[model samples]
Target: MRFSLLLMVCALCSVSQAALTFILGAHENVCFGVFTDQPRTSISYYFAVQSGGAFDVDYTIKNPRGEVIVTEDKQRQGDFIINADIAGEYELCFSNSMSTYAEKVIDFEIKVENDKNDFKANMPDQPNAKPKAHIENMGKTVDKIDQKLDELLRAIQYYKTRNNRNQATVKSTESRIYYFSIFEVLLMVGMAGLQITVVQLFFKGSRKQLV
Candidate 1:
């Protein structure tokens, strides 16, 4: 029985990672799923709005029992980590129902961490077994490296999202500025023509009165 339990735990340690991009239309909502078989499993997610209405969307996460774990409105980007105490299918949803005309571009990722290594490290040592101090130290080092890599990846994604938003803003501003400048020039020319016409009419009337 113990061996079977260990095997099950090891099987659960297989990590899953996925990145998704989707379009949410006006007044629409979308949902996705992730499944786990063990309690207290680590789940991480990150999401950003690449474009669309107000660059924001509403999001919700639910556990296996359909209990809401997290919900937010008008969020442009987010990162979250949670431990699932109940093993089953988890739901993630995004809503754009508040928007009337603008569609949204969304980029998101989900990652699950398996705990088999930690479980093995905590098991009792057998008789005549070698000291595990060096092995434990090596495992710790590897964990640290993995954590650093995850952080780096998150940072890169954040910067990319920020760059996309900045470019969109710049383009929108440039378009408005161009249109405003053209309108200003046309207004000035129209006023100058009106003023010249008025002056010419006044001189003509004065000449007629003098005659």
Candidate 2:
């Protein structure tokens, strides 16, 4: 039963979906192009800067006509769904040019679904009213379930990203603290040695003067 449910989830979620995690070097910009031959398709794009510098990046989305559909500057994460009214290639871009030395880890996903066609194909004309109603009801139920599953999947991704970022931060902090403590200890030891040397010199000079 669990295996079947997992399969169902995969089938529902695998509609032209791309999930990726990659490092964007400083002063580098990358763009991904998605081609859709059919018009009126739904496109879902999501991105998050997992770690680095300010945990932000510049991003832009453009239509096939070379027109900007959406653009953002120094953003940490975003989730957007836009309709592709014109059938062609769409571009999604990410830029890390703001950071000169730090590299950013980004997690993103893009999904394209022909929502209208899929629904219409699934629901066909039935001569028997009872069967038609039953089929329609089943389709609705399936759609609802699919939507809930998608939401759950997105939530899981979000938490996973957050966990990775937090872990990185904790490790960085630990390293800094460890090095700082060592430096502090060495400074204290050096100060003590200098004081001892000065005291010995003062005593020697006083003895010489007494003699």
Candidate 3:
């Protein structure tokens, strides 16, 4: 009975450790990759100046497409709240983009939070999780390559979507200009006819006086 209870406790701990964390040194940037069967619900983040930070920092979140989802500037240590409507692995970036000449040590924390308590509870108990790693560095390399390829595909799709929207906007603007030019030409013709009628009326009055 005790052994069964011990296994359950370990399983719970493993579920929590499933999250990944990273630290960025001063003037340094990094990328993180994520794999999830369930959708990610939120990004819980924190930032601090481990040393020599009297100024603010700039940070942003990027999707695989290199599109920025969220940004914060002149920010200090605090909790920034966010929600992802779609569930996938996302990137959190801290930029020294605004750091002054002085090399400042900035510390940031990121946790990929998922709120699937119901799903986690229903997770099949892994009684045989025996350090699942092989000596194949080649396999790891191949896996990394595959992951990169997937990201590239997603990025291309995102940019293509944006390009299509821009093209649509240009076409709409062209249509509007084309219509406006026609309208302006018609208005000018009407004004010219009005001027000719006024001149003829003025001459008829002089002819009647001569008669």
> Which candidate leads in lDDT?
1
How would you encode candidate 1's per-residue C-alpha lDDT over 21-124 as one tens digit per residue? Answer: 88889988888777777776787889999998579999999887999999999999989998877877777888999999999999988887666566766678
What lDDT does candidate 3 reach at residue 18? 23
lDDT order, best first, reads 1, 2, 3
TM-score ranking from best to worst? 1, 2, 3
Error of 1 at 93 (Å): 0.7
Count of backbone clashes, every candidate in sequence: 0, 0, 0
Candidate with maximal TM-score: 1
Write the residue-wise lDDT of candidate 2 on 7-82 in tens digits: 1112234257777788899999888877776677788888888899878999989998999999999998999898
User: Scored by CA lDDT, what does every candidate get?
Assistant: 0.82, 0.80, 0.52
The predicted structure with the larger TM-score, 2 or 3, is 2
Candidate 2 colliding pairs: none
Tens digits of per-residue lDDT for model 3, 47-115: 554333443456677654567877777654445545645545556555554544534444444444456
Q: Tell me the spans in candidate 3 whose CA falls farther than 4 Å from its real position.
A: 1-35, 120-211
What lDDT does candidate 1 reach at residue 174? Answer: 100
